[model samples]
Target: MGHDLDVLAARFGRHYPRWLLALLIISTMTMVLSSTSINVALPAIMQDFAIGRPLAQWLVTGVLAAMTSGLLLSSWAQARFGPRATLLTSFGLFLVTSLVAPFVTSIWALIAIRIVQGLCAGIAQPLSMVLIFRTYPGEGRGMALGLFGLGAMMAPALGPTLAGFLVDHFGWRAVFWLPAPVCILSLVGGALLLPTLRSLTPPRLDVPGFILLNLALFGILAALAEAQRFGWLHDATLLTGAVGLLGLAAFLWRCTHHSAPLLPLRLWRNASFRHTSWVSMVLGVSLFGVTYLVPLYVQTVEGYSASDAGLLLLPTGLVLGVAVFAGGWLSDKLAARWLLVGGLGLLTLSTAGQALMGTGASFWAICAWASLGRLGIGGIMPGVSTAAVQDLPAEELAPATGTISFMRQLGGALGINLLTFFIEWRHVAEGASAAGDAQAFVQSFWLLTALFALALWPAWLLRSKR
Candidate 1:
């Protein structure tokens, strides 16, 4: 097999790595598109299903929660089954879920399918990142991830616009149908491009740790979702929140005691990885929070059609694609902390700008502000991703990637839930009129701005001496 691969490598030469990276970018982008595109369609789905905002949000939260738990599985999966088999299995599952999702009548059924899809995506994301990091030379990894980030970030940036159009013309179900073709293409590409890399002695999956982690995530997410309806101090909310916090404490303890832990907590021993992980979580909150907030804001508050809401972010996506590539390239030459600080600064400005947006704001004005924030993200993604695992030893890379990805997804799941409840709480407080709607969204954007600003402290600490 080694000899055959050597011959194949010689035949393909330098192009082989590029082809593999391309396949990874495409497949991962499709996974992201399947999830992010749903944001614009949520209102439509809510109407069709006769659900409220809390339940409607499960469509998005379900994916993030399952995906967060799934991140821990990738290290074990890739080691046990090899990258080719693991990725193919993930792609296959995603393809099946994508095809079946549109036909479901119940929102719960659709949410269930989304959870499966998110799990498949969860398994694929870190694997792809590890493969990309391994494929490039040390000097070139920043550029390689930048290129990857271009596709990954672009999916969320553009996905909403396309989904909006589909929702307006065909219906919300059309959003699910969109990713199927891409999934099929990705399956074919993965079979041809991904290499078979497996550990001889793969770590065992920590069943107790996995269960505890999910319970923690589910309890927290459920508490947030329920908070808007039952009040934050209510017994149901308090109970769920307590369960989540306790589960988290137990999961952390298990990571240290378990022989084969799901996510090795020891990765945090590296100071750089710790700082970078903090920034990654903050980045996730910004990434998913804005995607969720803006679409709903424009449609519900400003009375923009779904298509118009989607269109608002199209320019932002394009900017992110270009900026991500540039940021990646720069990361290889410059200090990552410099880039992170600068990026966070830009994000702070962008979010602060967004807080001032209202119903009277022009379409182009909204796009400009959103695009500014994405440009900042392009800068952050490469620097943080590269810095997180660049210092870790070879054996620890897979778990490190899984851990960082887990943090990001965890932040996103909880961020969306919290933001959902915050908006609901504030909207009612403001009297629930057009004025109230605008104020609620403005306040939400301000909260995001503050989060971004708070992250700057950690971003500055990312390899400061370097």
Candidate 2:
């Protein structure tokens, strides 16, 4: 099978790298689409399952937690099984799980399937990065990554609108089945075109490190998830958060001492790696937090239907998709630092605009500001990611990519929790009036704006030149 794939890739390699990139982008977009599209469906799911906001949120958090855990295993999987085999296996699992998800009657069952789907997505995500880096030449690597980011970025951008339509017209189950055709195409492409690239020295799996990382991530997420319900200073929240912090400290210590840590401590030795990781975390916060909050706000506070809420982001997503490609192309020729700074600035402005948005604000005005923020995100993503590992050796690239991706997912999970906590806290304090809900959302947006501003300091630390 490996030999056959190699020959086939060579045959296709004759046409141009674009075809291979198309396959990868489609595969990756399916996973990303799966991730973001569900946000719009959460309310519908809540209605169907007769659950409250907190339980409904697990649909998002569970997938993120599962994806984060799956990311830790990706480098090892690629090293042990080789890229083509890993891609084929993961893609197949994703397709099967997504197909099965819509049929599950129980909410717990659906969440379980979502986690499995997230695991498959988590494996594919980092591998896609490695594949792009390997397939494209060094000079053109940014352009390749940019194209890949375009697909990944666009999925979230457009996914909600599509999901809203499906959920509104066909029911929430339709959202689960939306990615099937794309996944099928991606599966076929992976079998034929994905290269059989394997690490010569596969790293040992650090089972203890994996466990500690999950304990930390899951604990922190759970703490944040329940903080609003239990009170921020409640013993339960404090204990869970403390345990998570200790687990994180232990995980870091283990990485420093272990011969083959799950996440190599040495990756941080590079200045670029350190800065880019911080930027990626902030990017994740903005990206995922906004995606989660916008639809909920529009539907609940502003009285828009799910479809209308989803459509509000359509222009922003389209702008982001285009900007990502341009950002990638320019990163190859310009200083990444400028791009980072500029992108963060736009993100800050856009987020702040959202924070200041009045209940009576025009829909187009909201779209315009959000599109500006998405544009900024588009500029920062490709440049920051490319810069993160651009200086590392080939052997270190896989783990570096995995680490970066992990941080982003971690940030996303935490960001959603943080925003939710703030929203709930404010809503309770301000009283449950419709105006109060709007106020809570506005306050949460302010918090996000502050995060984007804080990210700029690290973005400035990024190396100016490639």
Candidate 3:
């Protein structure tokens, strides 16, 4: 009866394909916008805080720690609460968070709000994928995922540039305000257009699992992020990291054996799931690094201002949007394996090209590499997403989607941090000095290239869609 209600809602109301696509894009944009805006404003944040400088900025580190924690809860929330409620709640919190973020008076306060934003982000993203599976049927389903990717993936690509402009001309506060309406609009629009699909056999919230999982993540990531700055075995960070790892191991043990694990282990049984998870993990480390490094390349190395770097990256978002659409259409027609392999291959090449870049590399060369990488990323993301969750039964779709998406997010976070740490280590080893210098950035780019290459082996295991 409820399924019939959902059908009627989807059919008689605002119909799910194009309208829901718009909603999905808008919804994801709000989160993407928030994330990008924060990155652009980190400098202003330091100035406002009048705090000490660390090699890795606390603004980003704090957000990552928070987002990682949030990922632990997202799947459980979607399974227990229903995707529609989860999505609505996430966007609603996001809007509120974005509106008030600019007014934060202290660095810790800012970090706190961002941590909350990450939690909200966790709910919004995984739920977006789950909805497409539920609302979009047949080929339209593939199209829906593509459109969702366009908004989610492409937004961050363009956001840094836009945020740079807002921060330079306006204050950092403007960054928070710009996305306020977008979030609000997404909330209102989603409420109206998206069908009310409630959870089936809603599971009770697993509070103990949530606590254990988060403790593990917090300890592990904090240790990893801080260890590069602090020593591994000498510092408290090492202790924190060890605790987190132990917690993670325990969490896994529970997941594999528990009747109602936070994330059911059976989902990993799909070949696509296993492949995409590993590949996405590796790509996460590389792609996240590249996104951060790319802007730094143009601004610090090329001597362009933040605004210029952002504008240079603008074309990337356009290309990426186009790629997502094209990739999604092709995902349905072609087996994802070759597409996956080809996309990752191109991405690896682009990373290598970026790594080889010297201080004097031409502007056009940089732009060309960015475009190529975007194209490859466009092709592979849909394939990763579509293939990863393909074999799951209807009931498990949300968790499957959430778990894969979570891993990707997790990968990207770890990748960016790992790259940053590796580059910093290289710089210190070579006695390189300061931010905004091309010499300091060169080795880091190469390291990331190696990381991208490392990501390719997972795609080898992917079988052609038969």
Candidate 4:
């Protein structure tokens, strides 16, 4: 494979970057598609597994938590294993898990497999970003990452529709099967074209810090997931919350004091990166939060089928793909702070529109609202992502990319559970009528709108340093 790739590279030396981008995008897309495509399949999985929402919720949140932890591992993995080995290994693991998932006999087994899948995804994603950032010139990096973002976002945007169709016709298992072929292709591509960008002296993995971070993330998500069922003051919730907080504090302390920390704590000193990280976390709340909420609302409250719910967001996906490219192009031409603020404003408007929408709101109305939100996301991703690492030195690329991705996924995992808790709490408070369910969803959207509005402060702070 190495010899063949070398020959091919010599023949197409000038076009190497494009080929590399194409390979990375598709690989990353397969990983991201796996993440959100399962959202529509949640109902089916619940029914098949004879599980409640909170337990079934683990299938998603567990993966996000694992994925979030996996992001921090990218820099370490790249240093220890090199990029070629790391990317291929992650892709290979993802492929095996996707293949095995359909056959799991127990819900715990499936969730475990999915978490493994998420770990692989978490490792692969940020490395791809680092590679893209390295491959592109300064002038075109925004557009490059924008195109990369489009591929990543496109999967989540369109994945559910495909997943819904698969679930309706085949079964929930088909969603697991969906990424297998693409993952295989990615594996082959990585083996052939991936450069071995290893550190000169490999960094030792911080096993204790890694364990602490996962403990913190899973503890918090577990607490959030169960808080509505067990009161927030309940022992389980309180215990888990405390575990998460303490673990987080310990991990931060380790990052500050350890000789070779898992994360580069000093990266936070970059004011632009700090602002961008905040904006990214807040954006994840809206991005993944809405994706999880919308499908459940349409299917349960509005009496749509899974496929119907997925179809409603189909237009939004298409619009978002185009908007992301435009946003990337615009980032190169405009101040990133302006794009970030404008994007947040649009997201706030989109969620507010959804909040005010009644259960009887028309399909097109919902589509319009969803598309507006995605447009805002498209605008935000290119600007925020470009700003996060643009000013950092080359050596910080892996950790910087991993940190930004970590913040986003951390927000997403927690955000999804928090949104779920709100729905459950509101449903119980208002009684379980159809009206109550609809109102619960409406209230959740309002919560999202508020979060988006709150993000504008960080977005404003993303000004270019003189």
- Total backbone collisions for each predicted model: 0, 0, 3, 0
What local lDDT score does residue 436 receive in model 4, on the 0 to 100 scale?
86
Q: TM-scores, in order shown?
A: 0.91, 0.90, 0.86, 0.91
Question: Which candidate has the top score in lDDT?
Answer: 1
Q: Write the per-residue lDDT of candidate 2 for residues 1-466, one digit (tens) a residue.
A: 4444456657766554677788888888888778878888887888889976666676787788888888988878988888888988988888888889888889989988887888888888888878777667577776787678777888876888999899889988999888888888887877667778777788788999989998888788777766766767999889988988889999999999998887788999998899889998888877777888888888878877778888987888889888877787777787778888899999899879988876768789888988898889877887677778877888987678778888888888778877777887788789977788899988888888888888888878876766
Candidate 1 stretches with Cα past 4 Å from truth are 1-18, 132-145, 233-235, 269-271, 386-398, 461-463
lDDT of 3 by residue, 188-265 (tens): 876666555556776676676777787786676667666766777756787888888888888888788777777667
- For model 1, residues 106-223, the per-residue Cα lDDT tens digits are 9889989999998998889888888886677586776677677678888887889899999999999989988889889988887777777778898778888999998899888888
When 2 and 4 are scored with lDDT, the better candidate is 4
Model 3 pairs whose backbones collide: 161-310, 284-412, 285-415
How high is the CA lDDT of each candidate model? 0.85, 0.82, 0.70, 0.84
| lDDT of candidate 1 at residue 407, scale 0 to 100 | 86
Compared with the true structure, what per-residue lDDT tens digits does model 4 show for residues 1-466?
4434355467569687788899998999888888888888898888898886677778878878888888888877877877788899988889899999999889999989989988998888888877876667576776677678778888777888888899889998999999899888988877668877667798788899999888888888878876866778999999999998899899999999998787678999988888889888887776677888898889878888888988887898898888888887788788888888889999999989988987789999999998999889878987777788877899987578667877888888888888888888888788987788888898989998888999899878776632
lDDT for 71 in candidate 4 is 84
Candidate 3 Cα lDDT to native:
0.70
Quote model 3's TM-score: 0.86
Judge candidate 1 at residue 380 and give its lDDT: 90
